[model samples]
Target: MAFSAFSMTGYASHTFELPCREGLVSATIHVKVLNGRFFEPTFRLPHALAHLEPALVKMLREALVRGTVYCTIHIGTLFALTSRPMVSSVAIAGYIEALNEIKKHLPDSPGDLISAANLVGLPHVVEFVEDPVGHEINERILADFSTVVEMLQAERVREGAVLADDIGTRLDRLETAVEQIAERSREVFAAKRQRILENLQQLVAQAGCTEDANEVQLQHAFAQIEKLDVHEELVRLRTHIASARSILGLDSIEKGKRLDFTTQEMFRETNTIGAKCGDAELGGLVISAKVELEKIREQVQNLV
Candidate 1:
């Protein structure tokens, strides 16, 4: 029930002994995860434990949000260490009878060919006796597996904290750059407005207008200048940055997706600001903000 950022990539392995009524059973578990958009889990277990896959997958889904997860469980040397070896009398007898039939066809065949040692070497002549406490062993395995998954979760959380810290630093830079851009944008807008006024005055003088320009003409000129203003875009960029910061502060499992979307919006606003502002200094600031946003986007992709 822990709520915190978790990275989509992590690895954890554990080797321990599971005590059963039969004896001590050694088990090894490996959990690896890679960045993915969905919960995709792959399990590699002994055929005898194939039925445990669904339960294991349920455990994983409860603990993880999104990743390509790989789970490998080895139960003590292919289930041999947990079970005892037994000689199958029926199989040995069948092998001996078959060999005798072959011997009747070839009277000169060597008797050693059908010896006990040779028959024991044949397939199916020797079998492993399954553990008497099979259900208990499976339960123990599930318990151990849960522990390993918790270990994996801890590793992922640690990595996520690191990523979040890095991203927060980058966000600070982006926010600062955006503030600078906003400040510079004001200056650029003033300069643009002044140039527009100068041009309008020149046009008025060339036309030999004696009286001041009418209100409708002045309003039209101001409106044209406002069209090139990036104030709204800069405001949205700031809002997006704040949203991203807030998401980073939350204890939500799906913050990665939210941050990603916020970054995209920030990019859109940055592009709009760049397109609307023609000042060289403002363009440079927009570019710097874009670089920071790109870095944040990269880190956000690794979060869960």
Candidate 2:
């Protein structure tokens, strides 16, 4: 079977209300799949989500096959009316006093430290705002992942169809070559028998054997040589080829492995035919057919 480059990308978003919190949280997720040797997942997330990276990667790896997948998730928070800002007046007063004392000690230094510009730049000095809820975001990401997986499966099926067609064509070519080899081999057998008989006659005459005895021995020799004919190999090869074609027509995930095994059987039978026939042309054709089968095997490895 032959496979094309399979890929898919999807994005989805959803909003859900959190229990005990009178507000909605929204999540947007993007999923992408590209050809690769293994399942490699990458997560580009905000610092707030650093802890969730491991869990996300594990989930994606469990569901995905061979590909480089990228997942991006965005979470947004909507606070309720009751969520009011809480401020510590004493903390703010103490911060100002500490800054004034530092400026008094170092008169040459910048004394305008409590200005709006400096206050804006100070770490942890801003008015506190509500943190975004993320459970709904996680749920939405899972939903989007499900959709992406379905898309990937559909792509694989479409590519498998193309692969099956290509493999069928190659199988047909191989069967044709096998038939040619078998037909030519039958002719070679007749020529071989004639040559063997002539050699036997010359040997008997040189040894001064009587014509009657020579004739009997030559008949026995010819009978023994007939056992090497490849008629059985040809029959088995054709049977295996037919079975392989039937397998290609079926829509099964195991078709790749099954076809590979059948190819091995076909090659075995072809080798047997080559050895039995001992014809140079048949050997060459068998080798050529085996080469094509190997190429097919390589393509099948990437199949489902």
Candidate 3:
């Protein structure tokens, strides 16, 4: 399958006009996303259209994996046709009360300063009633929302492609360093075995040990020396590197957590090799691999 990735951040918006009894009314929908540990969504809808929030959130959850999603739907018109501005009695009463107090404070204030024209112009005193939308128009808005979601996912995929390429390069460097470590480890193991054999022979000779006794002692000592060999750790490290590459080739959007876990495993094996193998050159290679793994970990966090 082709390699694919998805970022947890993106934004998309769409605006269109729908025919209502009050002539053409415009609806603007926006979807914005940010990285998160799970799918979290918030919606802003007009009071008349609040019923659509549940369905819209479900749609986004299915389309995305991990992010803080924000969606807003605004319905309005340039001019009213069937509806007229309505005055709020409560707002006017509060304004008059506040204005009377102001007059008391300033006894010589101009009467026209607190006139009806001023009250009408104030916010919340007069609000335009919105015409109700039919079920058919709501369905059309839902369809347009799906389109915008697809656009957002497409952008995320494009950004993920860039992340995959950069991470792939770092993995390549790590693999090379691991191979070098493996080569150096073999030489270290052979030289250490030779020194152990020489020391054991001298101890056996000074003790006047028989040939059979000397052989048994050598076998027992060599068994303990094998603990310092890094062959097993190197094998596991290569396996982890392969697993990470396999994860990158997956076409699913669930790569981040899995890749992160594999990176931790790589660290585990690399650290073991560094501890067991005391060769300075092998230590340098292990440190280099660790640096590459850290870079890969940072990149995978941005993936979805």
lDDT of 2 at 287: 84
Q: Residue by residue across 124-201, what tens digits does model 1's lDDT show?
A: 988877654467778878888899999998999899988888888898899899889989999989988999988877
* Reference-based TM-score of each model: 0.85, 0.64, 0.77
Q: Identify the superior model by lDDT, candidate 1 or candidate 3.
A: 3
On TM-score, the leading prediction is 1
lDDT of 2 by residue, 15-55 (tens): 33333254554545566665555677887775555666777
- Which residue ranges in model 2 land beyond 4 Å of their true spot? 1-94, 103-113, 126-133, 208-228, 275-277
By how many angstroms RMSD does model 3 differ from the true structure?
6.2
Q: For each candidate in the order shown, give its overall lDDT on alpha carbons.
A: 0.84, 0.67, 0.86
RMSD of 2: 6.8
Prediction 3 TM-score vs. true: 0.77
lDDT over C-alpha atoms for residue 100 of model 1: 80
Residue pair clashes in candidate 3? none
Say which candidate scores most in lDDT. 3
Tens digits of lDDT, candidate 3, 1-304: 2357888788998998777666788888999998888999998887777878888988999989778999998777533422567899999999888888888988887885576887899989998876665678778888999999999999998988888888888989999999999999899888888888888888987999988898899888789688878888888888998998899998777899999899999999999999988888888988999999899998888888
TM-score of 1: 0.85
Residue 179 displacement in candidate 3 (angstroms): 0.8
